[model samples]
Target: MTSLLRISTLITTLSFSGLAVATDVVHFEGKASNTLPEAVANFSEYNDKLEAVMEGELTPEAMSEVHQLSYTLENAIAKMSKELDSLAETLEEVHLASESADTETVSEQGAAYLETSRELVE
Candidate 1:
């Protein structure tokens, strides 16, 4: 009887602990930027905000805010990563053309790469 009672108490404790963990899960509904320019803007803004919030000791409230801000940051990074992947391919074309001394291909792909890259820095 004592063993059964002990098992029952353990089960109850486990159930409550699981409930606590479930309640602690936070859901973020932040919107993602649709365009590269929008993503760049969001990435810059949220990155600065996140850095500012991390200056002091992290309280639960600050941690929660950081968690929410991370959603936008993640979205911006995803968009930028996709665009940069394409840009890298273009730059590769320029590199290969330059190596072979193909001035026409080099000029065309190099110009294309620089145009897109300038947008990213500006």
Candidate 2:
């Protein structure tokens, strides 16, 4: 009987506690809404300064220097590509030689296997 009474009391306490928590949440949300506009203005000012710097509105000459560097990099890449083509031709010759050597080795191994088998039979 005491356990049953204690359980009911606990349930009642929990129901009231949930209502109290919900009311507090609403109050805090209202407070936040009241202050949000000032916060947004402050953030807007900070963001505008950041945008100006990142968009290079801070220096006109920086973009020209960037353009020159980009051109140089493109030329360098073209030169390197030409050199790699020559290297690829040389590597292709080496690959063919290695394939020929492999074929010769396989033939020698086959001949040696026949000779060993004949000797074992004798």
lDDT of 2 by residue, 1-122 (tens): 99999999999999999989667622111111112233333334434544555577536465444443344334444444554455455455455656777655455554544443343232
Q: How does candidate 1 score on lDDT?
A: 0.89
Lowest-sum lDDT 10-residue window in model 2: 26-35
What Cα-based lDDT does every candidate model obtain? 0.89, 0.48
Which ten contiguous residues of candidate 1 have the minimum total lDDT?
A: 25-34
The Cα RMSD of model 2 versus the native structure comes to 28.1
Model 2 stretches astray by more than 4 angstroms:
1-58, 102-122
Residue 42 accuracy (lDDT) in model 1: 91
C-alpha root-mean-square deviation, each candidate: 3.0, 28.1
